[model samples]
Target: MAADAAPRSLSGKVLDVLDAFSADAPELTLSDISRRTGLSLSTTHRIVRELSEWGALERQGRGPYRIGLRLFEVASLAPRGPQLREVALPYLEDLYEATHENVQLAVREGLELVFLERITGRDAVRVLTRVGGRFSLHATGVGLALLAFAPPEVQEQVLSGSLERWTERTITDQGQLRRMLADVRRTGVAISDRQVTMDALSVAAPVVGPDDCVVAALSLVVHADGASPHTLAPAVRTAARGISRALGSPTARRHPAGARRRASGP
Candidate 1:
């Protein structure tokens, strides 16, 4: 076995300073940063100055600081994030137009699904989720689709955690979520009916990568009464297969064994 790598040393104060900024606290004063980071005022100031000079942080008009453009530029280079989104957007837009519903594209990060893009139809059902927002892997349709195809360790970790409930239909039980994931894998699609919102339903399918790993999920959320999950499954599956093909997934190059077997059955 290879030897374990040594941990790299970095000042706690520097990490603390960086951790102070969040999606909610995108901009903060030096005093606010110091309090949030639990660092001394002088140390916070020093590190903030260093980060600002290095283009990782930006000092705004008055005293607040925000993540800088340089960080955004660097983050855009991430292949699994923006790069994947760029390749999938056109296909997602097509699905949205066809269904006239809310279209979402997301990827799994740890046990959460991070929304990369969303397009809302003119008369689409309203949802609480937003772009760049993170959600649990056991709740939303995209989350379920991603969780279904994830590595076994990831599934175990999610099943072992505290599964929070969002609505009456949410799957808070580990056994139920496990069953749902198994069903998703078997059917090639996931359906979350009023799991996240009471009035909406989501249908999702996995987007596989060239390595046969699920890299993302594409979903359409529509009014629960307007469309049946069964009716939407085929469309979502087709779009997902198209995206997987574009990504060079070997599985997408051939029909699924079940389908092939069905075609050959007497």
Candidate 2:
């Protein structure tokens, strides 16, 4: 006789319902969630009601349910999210002031990177990134920096996996990507020219934690046509170091001898 499958845990079912909502579909009817999660309507209803009662979901007069403010409040407490943002914001602001471009802060989560904060000027080039959005760790400047400093196993997994190409300039070959990561490690910066979008370019640097381990990446995205990535790299690196210092990184506290030369140019 075939053994019966183990029953799914209630918490697992709850998480499935939550996962059904996303940036593309921020609101969903109970039936919508049921279909997405492959749960029966009745089971979904019960889970939804419990989540609603717990302030994880909110609905208005039989309308579709949306993620609740309470959930945001809970997510705010995560060290990688708001805490990192709090430490990085002032330096991010300084970078934004200096360049008036799109300044972004992101941290790696597995093979993906999540945006924590962004500051864009009124006339800055358009970018596809959104706060709280997840992006693959092989195409963006921030992603490249994070990947370069990532553990060897993580780097191998990304190198071996399918790399989604968003634009013609996106590097899909593993060998080329491996070389690019090496450059990022050697220079302390990553330049992604027209990788995500043809009209945009980004320069990024890694931000380390108190243990001198890279905990996040900081970047500046600008229009590709007239901008010089080499000119922008030092400023981006400097601001990233500032954020790392604020986060208590010992490496950031000790300035390298040639940092001023790099920041000021030849």
Q: Best-fitting candidate, measured by TM-score?
A: 2
How does candidate 1 fare on TM-score?
0.89
Model 1's alpha-carbon lDDT is 0.85
Q: Estimated TM-score per prediction?
A: 0.89, 0.93
Candidate 2, which segments miss by more than 4 Å at Cα? 1-6, 256-266
Question: Worst ten-residue run, lDDT, model 2?
Answer: 1-10
Please give, for residues 128-196, the per-residue lDDT of candidate 2 as tens digits.
899999999999999999999999999999999999999999999999999999999999999999999
Candidate 2 at 22: error in angstroms?
0.7
Q: Across residues 1-266, which tens digit of lDDT does each residue of candidate 1 receive?
A: 00123432347567667778888898999888878866668877888888898898987567689988888798899888889888888788888878889988999999899998889988999977777788899999999999999889999999999988899999998888888998999998999999988898999999999998999999999998867999887778877887887888987777542244356446
The positional error of residue 15 in candidate 1, measured at the CA in angstroms, is 3.6
Task: Give the C-alpha miss distance for residue 13 in model 1, angstroms.
Answer: 3.8
- What TM-score would you give candidate 2 relative to the actual structure? 0.93
Give all candidates' CA lDDT scores: 0.85, 0.92
